[model samples]
Target: MALGPIQFYCNTAVALICGIALWTDCSSRRISNRLILIGLICTGAVVLIEVYFKGDWQNAGGRLAAGGFASFLHGIPYVSGQMGAGDLKLAMVMGLLLGWDAWHAYMGYYGLVLGTAALILCLVPAKHKPWSLPLALF
Candidate 1:
């Protein structure tokens, strides 16, 4: 699907935020709540504009539902302590920006990449295995 100007801008912003998240995660081994909040606020603003000003409520709602769904799906891992809250928030923001189709594609690619990395990490016994999938994702 072709992205409109607002969608394009939102996607770009998400990409930039993801890069920042990656750097912070790698350097500090933690993704900050402030960064996640920035992304959520920015994406929420875009969705609000689309729904209120552009009268594109259907698309906006769909994207929001997708994000909610992603949050729920990722929340399981977060609750289990398999992933961090920031990662869950990041996944939600990505779903909000990409919608269902694109989010699905992105997750498929992410799973493939992450799975491969995990497999490789398992092969070589190291003192520490990478703890942050979000950093590897970015």
Candidate 2:
């Protein structure tokens, strides 16, 4: 699957969201609710644009479903205190953007990126307090 204009837009938005999230998380050891809200607003706009301007109504439901599914799936870990709230929210954003793909390439890429980060953390020594995985860098 080649990167199309829509995909580029989605990826760019996700990247920007993650970057801000990474900065705040690293600085304060927390992800602000406001940042998440801003990200969601952007996602909503993208969805609206896709549905109305692009006339891509067919994929609308899937995109929403993907976002919901991602949040729910990630929410599990969050509830258990295993994952940060920001990461869960970011995952949803990624899904909303990529879940439109018939093959779910966005979800796959998310899993790959997250899994690689986990693996790296496991291998590296943690000499200090728990270091949060900067989701944006992934």
Candidate 3:
């Protein structure tokens, strides 16, 4: 599938939020609520832009569905205390980027890969470092 500028924008935006959160957490020993909220707003704006500017993306229903799915999981993770508010914000951002078959595959593929890595991190013994998956896949 041909990649569009929005995908890059979404992924970069998410990475920026996550990186900021990770940095603030490391530096201050806490996640800033403001940062998380800002990230969510940024992500939501991107989605709205895509919907308004692009065609409804008749072929991208799968991506739309994936976005909804990720949002659902984001809630679960938040409720379970597995992820922070910034993380949920990032999910919403990425979901929108994956909109309407822009990547030719469902946006969920990105989340699945990410969640799988997260699962491995949780399940893996503390001895090994977590492998970083390439961000381009999103």
Q: How well does each candidate superpose onto the true structure, as a TM-score?
A: 0.83, 0.75, 0.52
Between prediction 1 and prediction 3, which has the larger TM-score?
A: 1
lDDT of each residue in 108-134, candidate 2, tens digit only = 676798898778778877784355555
TM-score of 1: 0.83
Backbone clashes in model 3, listed as residue pairs: 60-100
lDDT of 2 at 17: 74
What CA RMSD would you report for each candidate? Answer: 2.4, 3.0, 6.1
Q: Write the per-residue lDDT of candidate 3 for residues 1-138, one digit (tens) a residue.
A: 555676677667757766776676555545667765675576566656656777544524545665676678677867887656555655554555455454434344656977887787789787785444223222
Model 1 misplacement above 4 A: 126-138
Give the C-alpha lDDT of model 3. 0.59
Best by lDDT: 1
On TM-score, the leading prediction is 1
Q: What value of lDDT does candidate 1 attain over all alpha carbons?
A: 0.78
By lDDT, the candidates rank as 1, 2, 3
When 2 and 3 are scored with TM-score, the better candidate is: 2
